[model samples]
Target: MKNSNTSDNKDMEMKYVMVIETSDYLHRLEANQLNLFTQKLHNGISKLLKKFDSQILKQDDNTYIVLFDSVTNAILCALKVKSNFKYITLKFDKSIRHLKIGIAHHTNRIAAQTLSTRMCEVVKNQIVITSEVKKAYEKENRNTFINKEHIRTLNFSEEQFLTNLMNCVETIWNNSDFSIVDFSKPLKYSKSQVYRKMISLTGKPPSSFIRDFRLNRAMHLMYDRKGNITEIAQQTGFKNPSYFSKCFKDKFGVTPKTYSKQHAN
Candidate 1:
């Protein structure tokens, strides 16, 4: 184990780590098969996180780094995805790896070193969290999956809804005054029906989708060199750059300043 953090700030600040690791299944696949399946696995989990108003921060090959909004919700999502993976893999003739995870709460104070590196190290060391989280997820799997209506009610697939949702998100991502009501207005469904349909289709409410969409777009703009953080935030519908930085840091585990520095290198 790495040195134990002795900082007093540990209790006051909340930090979390989520690791998505595949088991022995990866070793069996050919190169093409490995790339294809891994990409699909990443997209699958990425979509699930967006629905939960979270984002995958960084990824190392098959290991994904995600800063979940909360520990409980994160665990539930991991379990749901893990449970669904078996079903998804059935269609493929080639072998595919199974997804499992490690979750850890970092209470240590933010030091001068890189936050992302430390977060990854601690979580990797705590392999026990993977099994513990997996167990807890299984216990809730029945309610989480059995009751969910996997069938499409609107004669549309989740992928279709996600595509449409992204269109809406892109349209409104630059408008500061944009609201869920505004975002939903363009849908073919009724306004009242749009909310529930969106919730059912995406596993997230309209409001969360809108907000997360903006933040994500802002982050993209940052990495793309479209503009600096403040400009990117404002252009992506955030009026207050400070508030934008706070939200970005909370969801991504690093301030925009720090993130930009790392990416610039």
Candidate 2:
């Protein structure tokens, strides 16, 4: 791979692209807080980029586009960022709580950008490298990249199914009375079919998927300071605050109340 500092170069040289997207939780912060949060995040990530000899190509709002000359450097930097993300967030008064990072390699910048965007949409709170990057990394290292879970290559139909399922879940996410039957109705699939497909695509059953969606929604609401824990729980379809806290803690390692307090202004 060759590095070109100028975009006008017509020569084809392989480059690794990394996309970093902060969670929507950051949107809830006030302007000054958001600026501080961005600064902290940028500083933390800048150190990683320097360590890996990469450079930031662009940054817009909560998203950053980074460039790496080597696949090995890109993979190592991404893994480091993913592992240290929580600690980086803790540096901010109003933390940017989650991230979705995608890495891809291609000779063309636009193609790499598209692949990275797709990978970001499919994964959450983690780093996902395209199969191309994964192949290059393993080949160059002469060893398997042990974190197979971080590599995802989704086909068109699987992507479409995930999009449809997410839309369906969004439509009825707040309905505490929502059931598997209700969930399957809008997807135009039989309950059994939906269950099997959900497991196949997401490695989670329908009920677990629904619960995770609700918990994620609850976290967004908490960051938005939309309501108290009880109101937020009920709004996200949890029948009670205690159960909501239990589930939230189980997934996030922190109760909703504690999370809210930690991110409070």
Best by lDDT: 2
| Runs in model 2 lying further than 4 Å from the true structure | 1-41, 47-100, 103-126, 129-150
lDDT of 2 by residue, 83-179 (tens): 7777766755444466778887767888677667645644443676666677788888886663767555444565556667776776887888888
TM-scores, all candidates, are: 0.42, 0.58
Candidate 2 has an lDDT of 0.74
Residue-pair clashes per candidate, as listed?
Answer: 0, 0
TM-score of 2: 0.58
Residue-level lDDT of model 1, residues 1-265, one tens digit each, is 7446743333333345566666224423445666777787778877887776554556754667666545557656756776767766777543333444555444432320123222222212212233333344446564642122321112224334444655576566688887667756676666667677666644457766566667656666665578998888888888999989998877555688886765563
lDDT of each: 0.56, 0.74
Off by over 4 Å in 1: 1-160
RMSD of each candidate relative to the true structure: 20.2, 7.0
